[model samples]
Target: MKKTITATLILISSCLLAQPVPDSPAYEHELQIGLAGVSSQSIYLGGKSQNRIFPAIDYQYKRFYFQAGDIGFNLIDSKDWEIDFGMGVNLVGDTDRGDSRLLKDLPNLSLPVSGFISAQYKSKMGLFKVKHDYEINNKHNGNSSSISYAAPIFKGQWLIMPKISYEHHSQEVVNYFYGVNTVDATLSLPAYQTGAVNNIQLSVLGLREINEKWSFVGNIQNEFYGDEISNSPIVEDDQRLSVFAGFLYKFF
Candidate 1:
């Protein structure tokens, strides 16, 4: 795990050295509120699960964006130049699990104060975004980071975004979710410890303005992760493909 995290950091550092930061100041801001639900036909932890719903909201001012939902709260601020800061709680699961066994097995499901800094640059050629974050206060430390690039394949209507991310968690973080100290071991449940994980993802997205108040959004994303992270006894699979269809309503 340590070796993988070191290599990922070195690669991202090399990429930063290879590219020159762009000079520009274009700002966009908005507020959004919506409802989200997830329905999956997969068995989790050897049990059948059902679909769930949750409310979501987001607020943006200048280069800052704030969001709150089932996943907790997130605050993102961008510098006009190529720098940014993000801080928030990252709650797992797309929907609330309530008092299910899944939640019981993972009691401390929230990564209480995860913070990271990022750098991003965009121009006529393409766009680049990088971010790194870690736990603020905890016995088990965990950190994660990602870098992504996007370019226009067919101009404004279509685009492709490719991203790579790495995550490292200390024994504390792993124990909270997958570890079984005597209590869990006696229950005959498998331990959930993980060393580190890396993820590579590719996504294709399209935007269409339907009229003054409505717009159409669609995207397909595929993700592949590294072994320690993906092969963990707790992790379901190493790959995933997701498709989303939604309508955006604008208020101005």
Candidate 2:
């Protein structure tokens, strides 16, 4: 997945040097570098949120688009509807801090990437989007789906979007991250398997344009875990919250 995504990125960058027809829309691009943090309330592995500064790329040329850490290409584009193919990264960071004994002895899981197909529609109410993804690394081999809404405000320069999404974890994924195998099961933590909806998240995204070349972005989200996830002996929290704020420089 990483290789395919990287190659696609290179191909998109090459488009920046291409010469479009006289009437083709001008190229649009943005680059951002800033700090981000996510504070998790999960009790599993005593995990804590992290803060890090990183660079982001937002590039759009005709039907192709890349934003933040995800990249997508439009398969269908029209006045009020669009279909896109996208890919994103999944992180299993900071699994060494929790107090759960069932989790303490477990090995840490590595990161995996996902690829998705999404469809979007715009109406008077707002813009609605839904997507389905699969883990491309075969590590977790998990599958997930999500639906979100976006409402642009202030002539579309500023925006507010509220979204809800649900994620299903494969038995393998749950076992690796939340399961207690027979060999490792103890009196307090028995062997268990999880293979259903494990996470549901609600979030709002806000963006404001400072000028033609500068803008600000912010988002806050709350995630609620399902019984399968919350019931794990390694887990401590039924819910968690995360936030991000950043700025960007746009070009044309």
Candidate 3:
């Protein structure tokens, strides 16, 4: 159930990225419900790829919004700029130990809840964003920041968006997820720690309005890891890929 919820949040986040909020929303109160699935490659050694299907829900009232497990408020809303403050579950970490025998002996890393502030700038060329997230749950007490750009293309009733992002994870975040302490180290897995690293991500999102109340959405995302992460004993891959798709019904 926990893994299902996590995957749902990830897919919801992707879908939301594809459809940015308009400066002036069409509805004062809005709700959307859907079914979504995600297939993701595992970056951990001896870890199997994960596939999950779960329900998605999103709600909005004026400047406040809730999407899946994320809740936020818009601090600034304008035609060209948007600033938001929110709390959300971090989407990138794997917490399940049952997925890999090699990881069974290690302590499980719970998903971190983070508080974030983000700013977005829209222009004719594209949308540019900068965001920062800090762990509020004391899980790792770490922080992350990202910069991204996305451009949208429209064709008839379909919208396609392509995005590229650069992300930085603090050393504490990396250590909590990938590091092996002396006590947990095994013959096959030695103690390891790595400094901060930067990662790159590329994604494309597609959405089609099936009708007034129904819509379809899909996204493909790929992440390339930094050398620090790839060199970790628990890591087996230098990259990960994820694909998600869903159909949604909107209620106003």
Best by TM-score: 3
lDDT of 3 by residue, 1-252 (tens): 576457445533733532643333546888888888888888889988878777778788888988757789989978899899999886555776327898889987787888999999988998899999999999989999999999888888888888899999999888888889999999999999989989999998888889989988888989899988899999999998888888889886
- Candidate 3 similarity to native, TM-score: 0.94
Per-candidate TM equals 0.64, 0.76, 0.94
lDDT of 2 at 214: 73
Off by over 4 Å in 1: 1-29, 35-44, 47-56, 67-81, 91-108, 123-125, 137-140, 154-175, 186-188
Of 2 and 3, the candidate ahead on lDDT is 3
RMSD of each: 9.0, 7.2, 1.8
Write the residue-wise lDDT of candidate 2 on 1-252 in tens digits.
343333222212211111111122435443443333333344464554444334446667666766544577879867678788878654322234233444666655555677879887877776677877788987678766767665544446666666666555556656666777788887777787766655666777666768867767776777787877778776777776666566666555
lDDT scores for all predictions?
Answer: 0.45, 0.58, 0.81
Candidate with better TM-score, 2 vs 3: 3
Error of 1 at 21 (Å): 19
Ranking by TM-score: 3, 2, 1
